[model samples]
Structure formats: structure tokens, C-alpha cells
Target: MSVDRDTVLKIARLSRIKLEDERVEPLMGELNNILAWVEQLDGVDTTDVAPMTSAVETSLAWREDQVSDGECAEDVLKNAPVSEYGFFAVPKVIE
Candidate 1:
């Protein structure tokens, strides 16, 4: 697949990029080159290859599923400018 002039402009608008008229042609060529390289990758044989999530094989460590407060509420409240009833206190913003 290749990108045309209109596609480049549409991409710029979708991305909120302020692309100049002079830059559209160059950007179109760059995008087309990228798509062409990706298309070339589709020609490779991956039938025997196994899908992998990471370059280096590793397993996550098992852990017990438990929930508990971090037990640092007092420590955390010390940093607050104003705290009350075991919680941070802020000025009321609405009536």
C-alpha cells in the first residue's frame, strides 16, 4: 500500500499537526516508503517461528493474591499541608 497526497493531508489533520503545503509531497514519499518496507516484511516465511512477547524469554514470579492497605497512611499524611479524619483536607470548591 502507498500513501497519496490527500492521505498525507488527512493524516496531518487527524494528528493535529500543522503541515505546510510544501511539506506534503515529501511526507507522502516518506509514508509510502514506510508502507513499502512493511509490505516487504509480509513476504518473509514465519510458519515455523513461534510467536514471542519479548526478545529474551522470561517467566513472571508467582505471588499470593492478597489485598491490604499499605499501612503508611500516617507517613503519607505527614506530607500533607492539612489533613483531617485520616485524610487529606482541601478547600471546598463548590457550594
Candidate 2:
């Protein structure tokens, strides 16, 4: 999984990054080192490890699902500059 100079240049081009020719060699080495570290992670044994969504173990509080008007339409309409028929009113833009 070592990164070559051409591969580095191709990646830079695809990403639309303006990488200089002189910087390509150094970037290639850095990318290769990162890939080597990731490859090392494959050797770890995880047969007993359970996949988890979060590191902390916790349960969400359950609530009954009920549908109702929030009853705050009047409160919200107060902020509008002009409201008509229980809704916000704006100048018609379409001709």
C-alpha cells in the first residue's frame, strides 16, 4: 500500500489541489507512512469485540408519540410584520 510519486500527483490532481512538483516526493512518503500504520491495524484480534454506535453505554428516554397542534401559532405570529388568516402574509412576487 505504499504511495508512489505518480499516485500522489494523480490524487492531488483529482482533489483539485495545487501541489508543487518539489512537494510530491515528501507527500508520497507521508502517505506511505500513513497507509503502513493503517495496515498494521489489520493484525489486531477483535473476535470478541462488539460493534457499538457509541463508546458510552446509555439508553434514550422513551416517550409516547402523540400528534397535536403546538398551540403556539399566536405566539409565533406575533413576530411577523404582517399576518393574515392565522398565517404569515408577504407581498406576492409571482406575476
Worst 10 residues of 1 by lDDT: 60-69
- Candidate 2 error regions (>4 Å): 47-95
Quote each prediction's TM-score. Answer: 0.50, 0.47
Q: List the residue pairs that clash in candidate 2.
A: none
Give model 2's TM-score versus the native structure: 0.47
Error of 2 at 55 (Å): 4.6
The residue pairs in collision within model 1 are: none
Estimate, for each residue in 1-95, the C-alpha lDDT of model 1 and write its tens digit: 77899999898999999998999999999889888878987889999898878887788888789875688889999999999999999999798
